[model samples]
Target chain A: MPLISQQQKAVILMADDDADDRYLVQVAFEENDIQCELLFVEDGSEVFDFLMGQGKHEEKGSKIPNLILLDLNMPKKDGKQVLQEIKALPAYHHIPVVIFTTSKSPEDVRQLYKMGASSFISKPSSFDKLSEVVRNIGTYWVETTMLP
Target chain B: MRKQTLQFLYASLAAAVLLLLSIGVFTFRSLRSLIEQSDAIAHTNKVLFQTEEVISTMKDAEIGQRGFILTHDSSFLKPYVDATQYLGRQLKLVDSLTNFRPQVVQRQRVRRLFYFAQQRDAHIKQLLAASLEPNRPDYDLRLIALLNRGKATMDSARIVVDSLQQTEKLLLEERIHHKDQLSANTLGLFTLISLLAVLMFSLAFYLLIQEIRRRQNYERQLEKTVSDLLRTNQDLEQFTYVVSHHLQEPLRKLQTFSTRLVQKHAIELGDNARFLMERMGSTANQMQTLMADLLVYTGLGLHGDTTDFEVQDLAVVFQKTVENHEKQLSAAKAMVQFDKQSWPVLGEMEQLELLFSHLLQNSLKFVVENQRPHISVHTFVITGEQMPFATQSQHDERFVKIVFTDNGIGIDMQYQDKVFGLFQRLHTADNYPGTGVGLAVCKRIVKRHNGYIHLAATEVGAAFHIYLPLAN
Candidate 1:
């Protein structure tokens, strides 16, 4: 498992418009006891800025994320557009994108899957369910799955 | 614009009637003229017949005189005696007939012919009387000369009769030609009028068809507008669901924070603070449940995904609903009994399960003191007329009426209709912990199945009569 490797650390990037959601995801990730570096962005455009190591993220120790949790509803650019761009680009195409949104619409689920989304999850109403979903995602992507 | 079209149609009809009337009048005039010409031709024929009869009667008189002159048989003079009277009457008839303005020349010839006929008659009578005498000077020469004179007079009468007959024949031919021309013109006019009437009627029919087509187009446009409004309404409902979800976000945060505040800081927060936090959490939970129930009420069948509906047994659905309230039923030790008669109902199973669950929960919630909840499911077959809200669904006219009776506080007859409305409850939240959307949801589900649900008045407990259409 990637987490069992002592020398290496997995990086996870989450993009959401709501600050409380971003903070709650961090707490939920920590509550599962899964050791991973979690990064947060306010919107979909900041996701690109962080990935490109530009603007405020232009530091020497900046790292590219191994997994991206994308929110569908955001200002300037939506998660769908960002997902399309990340999938289209050569450098970030291999990184798995998980759609985390409040929409439980079947059409959104089907469409996100069709647009090369790795997984789709409707935001749970309770913190317990949120923690449980976050644990599953972290365990599967960071610990269980093999990466290049 | 329609009025203009109708006015034009009326005008065209009036023109058609006027044209037909004119054609009729013209035909009548032509027919009348043709009849007059026919009468003129008959008059000419009568004149010609009379003239020839006058000549024939003269020849008959001359034969009688010759027979008497040769044999001196007085009985042969009977024909000559008869001719004198008959010929006089025939001449008078001819004179009166040809006295009209059109037959003036024929009338003059008839007068001349009458004079010649009288002269021949006197000579024949003189010869016959002379022959009867005993002796006379130059008797043979006189008889021969008198006979020659009678022959001459008959030739003159024949010539006048021939001329008069020839003029009458010409008049008959002219009258016949005029009548033929008149009928030909009438026939041409009749054909033209018939063609015009056909054209006028075709134009009116075309106008009517155009008006009908325009109305059909308008109806289609109205239908399109109504469907557009329905689609807009669907979008608004979806938007409402999303907005309500967003609104519940803060309530969720409050609930979580209040719970965490009590769980982690019970020692730092006094009993009063903890109790307040607990109350806040409970309030948030109630609000969340209300929001969720509201969402469910707004979102029923919004996607129109009823393709999973099938013929399901109503007893099984009721059983599943009972299972949903298994914990409550076990605690209450409720007695739930279904009739042995099979209930084959058609619907989406999950919705039916929800519907029955709401009814059972309502019965459980509304209870008399110390009364064990006893529910009995009864079934019967009924026709459409027996059901008040019967609709012409894509099913048969026969329906299966399911009666669900429970031993609980029965609803008042007046409040029976009111209970089905959204957010309408008889008891306060303290008495019955609910959002008051259960019966409304049941009504919606029943309506989706093309059925009806109504509260029936029962002397004992509450009875809900559900009428579901049968499918053959």
Candidate 2:
């Protein structure tokens, strides 16, 4: 499998309810110059709608996202519930899901992994670390593994 | 008193009672034994007197028989004749007087001897009075036959009677020995009883003294309780005076700062500054709530009012609280579910109203954004048939279970312990806004009424279980 450059990568889906947290993550990604189409949803409910080709993402031309960054705490449906729903569906089961949240609980990490999350990362407390994390995640996702 | 102290007091009192009972039993047993010894001594005396009478009758019969044979005189036969009748009477009397075996046997032997002597005297009188033929050999032969018959009979009877008399004497000696042994045993038993009585009495005395000391100690403890209460009263007074004086300074500062900020810095401040100022205002308000709750908590502990007031309808209080927070509930689009079973609880109506309102407000305030809020209220009564602690009982010290649940921004498991602390807050002021005094106030109120609160679970949302003890 040939490696795709960061610029060639398709959209990466992000789900989070906190506006400040989402803005901070976006700023970190831009500062690190980890280029890919970044698509965002406000919560797990919206994430499900986008994935299932319902609500605002019913157009078939919009490509399925290559990867997902999930936050655990959200309205309507939490990230843990979304992870469980996604893993249960055969079509979306192979798509890599990474848990990204402000919660540093070991219990949360254990639970997310148990639900078939690809990786779990605590949302970095400082901006500098968050920027570094964004760059590394981007490098690994875009330039390394072959997308299904 | 502590449970350990109460147990010690009960144990000491039981020991004292046991000691007294043991002494009483020992005294009763000793008196019974002394009466038994006196009865045994009286039995020994009767046996000895009957034996003596039998010996004297045997001696008189032997003397009279000897006098009649030696003198060949009818006048000498008088003692022998009288002896026979006397011996029969003595034997009958001895048999009636004593149960002793040897004495009765002796009396029978003496009667046999006395009868033999009388027959011999009759034969001698016949020989002396006869005036028939002078045939010497025949006469001598007759005399020999008569003499031998009388001698053999008398000798056999006398030997048996003497042996019997000796046997009776031996039995009398044995009876005296037995009496002495019984006396010794009684004395020993008496000494033992006395010793036991002394020991038991000593124990009782010691226990009595100990009881007195314990009673004194208990009195002292009561005195200490009174003194402690007095000291606690003094401390509370000092606390009220000092805390009131101290609290006024901070409150005055808060008011002064707010006034100054409004007058002088209102124009210079940005959005962040105004936001900080609003938070400051909330903190002051929270402190004021805390002080008022503390006052009520202290008052509840001090005053217990037993009144015959009927249980006020909880629905009224609920309506008033909902009306007060109607704006917030409407904004959140919250729903309230109440089980309207009238539960008559003994409590101050105002305090109960405050407790329920605070809980309801907490449920409404912490709802997840864009989610409709929900609250459920209900009453459950426990009967004696149900397992204890799990059941809520009426008019007993058993708890009235009140569970408040909400699907909100749930607290983490680690922060559960800190929820009821005076100023413990998990979220930053930028996110969820609270002064962290509400749970503390709830804790104080619950504790004042001898109730308890605990965070039941936080799996997806928060659940708080409050248990209030029902009054008997």
**Top-TM-score candidate index:** 1
- Candidates' TM-scores? 0.67, 0.52
**Per-residue C-alpha lDDT of model 1 across residues B420-446, encoded as one tens digit per residue:** 998898888998889899999999889
Runs in model 2 deviating more than 4 A are A1-148, B1-185, B215-219, B222-234, B237-246, B261-310, B384-400, B412-417, B458-460, B469-472
Per-residue CA lDDT of model 2 for B1-472, tens digit only, reads 4455555656655665665565567556655654554454454444345445544554565566556555756686676567667766765664554435445565566456456545545654554443132356587676567666656755665565556556656765765676567667656765665566566556556666766788999999999999999889768855874474346334534544554464457779977888887677667756655554454444443443435333545556566677778898888888887776555556666666667777777787677888888877665655433423343443434555766777777667677679888657777756766666667767766665556677777566678877665445
Span of 10 residues, lowest total lDDT, candidate 1 chain B:
B387-396
Task: List where candidate 1 sits over 4 angstroms from the true fold.
Answer: A1-16, A28-36, A41-148, B1-40, B46-137, B144-214, B257-283, B305-316, B340-346, B391-396
DockQ by candidate, in order: 0.20, 0.01
Q: CA lDDT, every prediction? A: 0.83, 0.66
Q: Per-residue alpha-carbon lDDT of model 1 for A34-93, expressed as tens digits?
A: 778888888888898898887778883456788899999889899999999998999988
Chain A TM-score of each candidate structure, as shown: 0.93, 0.90
Q: How close is candidate 2 to the true structure, as a TM-score?
A: 0.52
**Interface RMSD list for the candidates:** 2.6, 16.5
Candidate 1 has an lDDT of 0.83
